[model samples]
Every structure is written in C-alpha cells, then in structure tokens.
Target: MGGLLSILKGGAKEEEPIDIPLNFGAQPSGPEIEYYNAVAGLMRAAPGILNDLRSYSGCGEAIRQAISNPGKATEDAAWAVVCPAVAKLKDYYDFSCALGNAMGAHAGADQQAPVVSPTEQLFPRILSFLGNGDASQNFEQSQALARKLAEILDFATQFDNLKARSASQPAGQPATMSNPNVQNDFSYYRRTVSRMKMNNAQSVAVVSDEVANKMSLFFAHSNPVTKALIDSANVAVMSRTLSLGGATDVFSILAGVSYHMVAKGRAGNDSAFFLRVMVVSVLLYDHIDPAGAFIKNSKINIKASIKVIQSSGGSGADALLNALRFSTQHLNDETTPKAIKQMLAQ
Candidate 1:
C-alpha cells in the first residue's frame, strides 16, 4: 500500500517551491529595458522641465541666463535632487535654475512629484488681465495652475508621509517594506496622481473669477517680490472675487488707487517694482465695490504711501517714488490726457 501511495504521489515530498532572487545584472528584457529607459528619460527631462517653469514667471534675468548658458543650469538642476535642497536652499546665482527645475518637474508632462512654482501663480494673475478677451484661454490658464498646485501639494503630502513612515520603520527589514502607513501613503499618492492627470486631461475652463482670485492670493504669498506686488495681487484677487459676488466697479477704482499708491507714491529700484504697481492699479480698477465701501483704507494710503513717497535717498523711499513716477506716466497717461499733462507740466 505504501509503494502504491508513493507511485500515486509521483515521488512528491510536498515541499514548498524555493524563491529565486531576481538578478539585475543580466541584460534586461525588452520590458525591463523600456522601464529603465523611461526612468532615464525622466532623469534627462527633469532639468529642462524646470527651466520651462522659470520662463513662465517672466523672470527675464533667469530666463536670459538659462538661454545664454545651458551647461550651468543643467549642473544646478542635477544638484537639486534632495527634497529640501530643491524646496528651499537655492543659491541666488542658481536660484532660477532650481526654481525652473521644480516648476518643470511639477508641471511636466509626467506628473511625478509636483512642486509649487512662483511662475505658476504669476502666470494666471497676468493672464486674467491680459487674455485678449479669451475667456477660454483664461480658464485654461487657471486650470493649469490649479492642476500644478494640486500635484505639488499632493507630492509634499506624500513625501512627508513617506518620510515619517520610513523614519519610524523597524531596522533589518531591508528585503521588504510593507508598513501599513507606507501602503496608505502610496494609495493616497495614487489617488492624487489620478486627480492631477484628470485635471490635465480635462478642459480647464473656469466659469468664475473666484478661482482666479484665490490663485492670485496664493502666488502673492509665495513669490519673492516687492511688498507692493504681494499687496497688489491680494487686492486683485479680492477684487475679482468681490466682483463675482456682485460688487460693481470696485476693482476698477481699486486699480486706479493701487496704481497711484505704488507708481507715483512708493519707492523701489527693482524692475518688478513698476510692474507690480501697474498690476495692482489694473486689478483694483476692474472690480470696484459700492455698497461695502471696501476702498483703500486711510492708514494704508497715509502711513505706507507717505513713508514711501518721502524718501530723498535712493533706497526704499527714493526708489519707490521713482517707480511711481515712471508708472504714473504710463498709467495715468501723463502725455495724452490734457488735464494730467497740464498738471504735470505745471
């Protein structure tokens, strides 16, 4: 009976099959090589992606350098592998390069690890005003900004979650990392990635100005620009939201007031100084509120403007006045308008 049973079992001992290690050194299969090729593509594309983002912000100097010297930008981009280094610690010389890389990676065709870009913020705000009456384009711009922001925030959240899990992981588990927390984070990342891709795939057509305004406020806080620019963008976004909420001409008046406040009244030598003043003026003028009296407060005009306009030296006050004068000529039309021209002529 034992011999018969052994014959029936065909010499099987009921032993479990041994697992073999995957050898990475062997020349990769087609699919494996393709995957590796994709990764290499990502590595090579990462830097140029960043440069494209930097260009979006209209940072003429940075763009100029990137265009003028590609080698330096490429090196700086490679150095930005570390998350924190990519996020914050960028040298002034290589700041644009780093910023470019982050933007590129965030807004790249492949949504791997999104990051916030100052350019993304500025682009929408600028586009809203300068869209040549193309609401579709404006909406598209807004949607793009939203998608990029979502991706970046998602990346940050996932990175943080992963780092926390990795830190808390028990030692000696090198073969497999199967922590629940890590799994959850991966799930979340997957969802976020899907959402971002969906956003990209869909037509980004914002129906309301509220979305634009929020984006403007976000950029105002993030980018390193003059205080006037921040304040102006905030006001612009606020004006747009208010207009959408039934405020009439509040933005228009605000624009004029903001324009005068910074262009002829403030100080700064920065190239963006004049542009920011002009932007605020345009934004405020577009959406002026009547019922609530959301006009420029007395204190902002008095304390801030007085301090800015009073400087005789070329630092804060003096530079601000110079910017104001330059902007006023263009905004207030010091040349064409007879009354303004006469007043200035006098």
Candidate 2:
C-alpha cells in the first residue's frame, strides 16, 4: 500500500519537517471522523479489489475463447471457465457494494445534517445493478437496441429530407429522388422497425426506441452525485460494442460491462442501488469533484495502468503492487483532497 501511495504521488519531493504543538488531550470524534475512516478503509481495500478483478479477467478471456471456438471446446469446458469467473466477479462486486453501503449508513447516522434516505438508497441499488449476472446480458441487448435505433434515426432523417425536397420544388416540377418505388421501400422499412404495441388503446414504440429515449435522458441530465455511475454505464456499452470482433482487451470489457449496467438502468431496482453506491463511494473517497471529471480521469488511469501491468506479464499480485505504485505516483498530479491523502498515509 505504501508503494502504491508513492506511485500515485508521482515522485514528488518530500515535505520539510515542521515543529507544531500537539493536542494529546483527546482524539476527534464525530461524523467527520467517521467519514475519514471510511475513505481510508476504501483506499486500503482498493488494491485487493483490483487484484481480484485482474484474476477475473483471465477467466473472462478463457470463457471468450471457449465461446468463440466452440468446435475445439466443449460446453463443460466453457462452464468450467464461466462459473468460477462469475463467482469471483460477484465477490468483488459484493465487497465494493458493502463498502459503499457502510459509508452511507455511517453518514446518515450522524446527528448533524443527516443524509437523506433517497441519497442513501443509491449505493445498494448501484451495487445490485453492477454486481449481478444481468449486466453482461444488458450489454448484449444494448448492442441490438443501438443498431435498431440508428436505423430509426436514419429513416427519420431521410423522411425529413424528402419532405423538404417536395416543398422546395417549383410548381409542376418533379422532386429529386421522388420515385414512388423508393418512397414505398423507405416507408416499409420504417414502419416495420417502428411498429407500435397497443395496450388499452395506448400505443408504445418498440423496445429499441424506449431504450434509446432512456439513454438520451441519461446523457442529457446533469446530476453530480450520479455522474460516475452514469459514465460507467456508457463505458460499458461502448466496450461491449468494441468487443464484438475481439478487438478490445478483456479487462476493458469487464469494466465496461460493470459500468454499462448501472448507466443503462437495465437492472430495474438494481439500477437505483448501484447509482447510490457510486455517489456515496466518490463522496467518501474523492474530495475533488466527487461526481465530475476527476473520478472519470481516475478510472481511465486505472484501466490504462491495469493494461500496462498485464501486458508486461504481471500476475494478479504484481498487478496489485504496480497499481498501488502508480496510484501513489499520480496522487500529487491531481487535486484529490490533502486530508484524504494524509489519512491514507497513516
């Protein structure tokens, strides 16, 4: 952990010694202290959590290989890889979720300015959303949904263009690309894709459109507390899309899937749980922009560091060690709170 802290600090000069008065009468006690302790605990546990994830990535790769080349691998072989991988993933997710939950509970228990129940509710919901098996499934579903939405968007654009041409044409003059056959084909495809469901005489767009609308709202809204959770979900969707051709690395795929589930809001009640976890986790650990760019950048750096460590033939233990080193090195490069850093040092 010390090594990791050093790495995150980025090789800065050591501070000069200074004489100061000591308050030895009594140690501080209050919600502030509880919050400090919680964040310190998270910092200490982060490397271990990362180590487990690195191991889980290996399992993810084995499962991927087995699935891709089924002719050479049996179903039993695939399950052998998948079952253990899923179990490890679950363990990591549960630990992180629990940490977030404990933090929120402590915060709410404070007598002064107690945290609202809804805010406290977010942690478990975010965890449940990201920790479950459905996350991967949701990523898969999102791909299909995205493609269909793209088609609908294209159709809408084309229809608007056609209408514009018709209106702009001179009287008694033929419009450009105004062939009846082409128009009919376009209408057919559009109607087929946009087919509606009728229940109680109320019409609902296809599932793809509904998902697209949700995604739009997620991106459009600006809620600082839920920003990390939302960004993680977006990353998950992009990562899954990239993995289709096996171009993306295994570690990225894992991170992306975890984020995607929470961001996509596909886990029903689980979504709320995971969002809360993310909000509380950041507020506890990161003092600089708890829900902003700092958290996003930290995630990016962690992923890059993991990739570097794995590429150099590092084992899970080595990865953890190196991650600690890297985190310590860069700690000084960012605006993470000084108090939080000092707490970690202790």
Candidate 3:
C-alpha cells in the first residue's frame, strides 16, 4: 500500500481523448453499450491494458525478487510493481502503441494509408481483431489456453458434459467449428501420429497450405478443440473444480494475451457475478458463431444457451456457452455481422 502511493506523485501526460468505435450497423444500445463502455478504453488504449496486465503478472515475480532484496519494493515499489529493477525502473519509457491505431486504421506518418493491413489491424493490437485469437481461446480451440483453463476456471468437473456433447456428435456432419474464416485458427491442431495415414488423420489427403482454400464441407472430430478434449477427458475428469477466481481468470487471460497492444477504460467488472457474466458472453457467442466450437454439436437457441448459463436456478447448462461479455472490440468493429452484434448486445 505504501509503495503504490509514490506513483501518485507524478502527473500523467495529457493526450487527445479517444473514441470507442464498436460498429453494429446501427449504434449499439442497452447492454451492448454498457458492455462496449466496459471495454472501449482497453481497446482504444490497449497498451495501457497491457501495462495493467504486466503489473498484475509482475506480482508473482516481484515477490520473488523483493524477497531477495528487502526494502526494494518499499523504496521504489512503483517500478517494482511494473517489474523493472529499481535501478532500471527510472529508465521506464512508454510508447503509446494503440493511440495511432485507435478510432479508424490511422496510419503511421511514415506509412501509406492505402497499404493498411489487408485485414484490419485493430487498435491496441492484442485482439488481432479479425484474427481468431480471442474466439479460439474462449471456445477451447486453442489447445494451450484450454489446458490452462482446465487448471484454473471453475468448470473442470464439467468435462463430462463437454465429452457427452462431443460424443453425441454424429459422424459426417457440419460442426459448429466449420466456418472457413476461423478454420485457419486451428493450424496448430493438424497433426498426424506415427501410424495414422491420411485415412487415420481424418482423410486420405489434407493439404496444409490449401487446407482452407478448399475441402470437404463435412468432418468429424477434425475440429481440434473436440479432438484435443475428447481423448484428454476420456482419460480423466477433474474431481475438483479448479479456479483462479473469476476475476483472476478473466483478467489474467486478457492481460496475458494482449501483447502488442494496450488500451484503457472501464469501471464495472465488479458484478459479484462479473466473471460469470463475462464468461457467459464467451459461451453464448461461441454457440452463436457459425464456427462456435464449444457446443459445436448442439442445435440449441442462443437465448436458451444464455438463459441456461445466466440463471443458475435453471442450471447453467454446460456453462460453456457464455462469453466474458468479452464485450470485446469485436462488437465495436464493422466486420461483425449486424444480427450477431445485436444478439451479443443483449
């Protein structure tokens, strides 16, 4: 507490006010606006978000270092909290990476406006907006993130529910993860064991480069998320529900994942149910998305999915359909389809 006080002595630099632009054809209203307001600052100034994340992530390492050098944190905890050595802490210099990219795709003065990334480079780059980073992580498509999610979130015991969902999947059908846009997101999932020929690898042929260019419209567990969890779940279901606390779970992932970008904003992730509320968003959206893989096999309605997760009285269903109210900039972007954005807003 004493250490946090010193940083308050310095005056923060002034910058132009930034706008939070989440395009939903028409302006987003009600919960959508509230959700947008919640994350707009982070998207607009994602670097600041990164710093907060870095500060949070630094706590574990800082304690280890602080133990080795007593009074270092008390002498200069501000720098210590940000994870720089007290000696180097004074050298801290910041670049506002998201300031340029916020609003529209503002180009660097040296760069040409016409040559912006073929795909939009979202502000505060952590989102990679159009890319599948956030989505895949939420839906358990990212193998690494899911393993961690299992270790931390309160849903480990629900693995059977997940397996049952997967087991229920009929062979040769359109999976929730079949969307071509998010298909490349699973590049890491394409692997072949020693004896599994293309036949065993889910096909007689799967061209890596052209995997997305063209392919059969139907597949079984080729969806890496299902394939990864199916075998892992069959081996064991966690007896205990492991969780890093809802706030920690959500904040840690956002902080860890937002690397090249940083943004600042928001006040209310404090709903006693904030983590559940936010997580619920991820689940619901994933369910709604054509490529949503969490409940890839279910034909349930999105609202029903939301209701199941939101109303514990009714049962949180599988509890995988909700999103963080990840209220992410995705809803803010023009790329998001109107109907989906409207649905997400509610």
Name the top lDDT candidate.
Answer: 2
Q: Give Cα distance to truth, residue 243, candidate 2, Å.
A: 41
lDDT of candidate model 1 versus the reference:
0.29
lDDT of each residue in 1-346, candidate 2, tens digit only:
3432232223123211111111212232432233334334444554554444333223334444545766435534644544444344344333433333222222222333224343333333332332234333322323332222122222222222232233234322222233222233223322333432322333332224533333233222222113323233233333353221111111122333323334444435543222222222222222222332123323223333223223432223232322233222234445644543442332
Cα-based lDDT at residue 308, candidate 1? 31
- Cα TM-score per model: 0.22, 0.25, 0.20
lDDT of 1 by residue, 1-346 (tens): 3332232123123211111111212443332343333333333433443443333222223333433665656423422222222122122112322212323222323444334344423322432332224322222333333222222222222222222223444321221232332233223323333554676844222212332232232222212222223233334345462222221122222222333434453323432333233233322222122221112221112123323334322333432333333322232432233432333231
Q: Roughly what TM-score does model 3 have, to 2 decimal places?
A: 0.20
- Which regions of candidate 2 fall more than 4 Å away from where they truly are? 1-45, 54-57, 71-73, 99-346
Error of 3 at 261 (Å): 37
- Compute the lDDT of residue 77 as modeled in candidate 1: 40
Per-residue lDDT of 283 in model 1: 25
Residues 1-346, model 3: lDDT tens digits: 2221221111122111111221112343432343334344323433343343233222334343434675635424422233232112111111111211211222233544342241122121212221222332332233233222322221211221232233334322223433221222122123221223544543332243232222211122223222222212211112112121222223223222221011221313322222233343243223223333122121212233233344431233223332223322234445444544455453
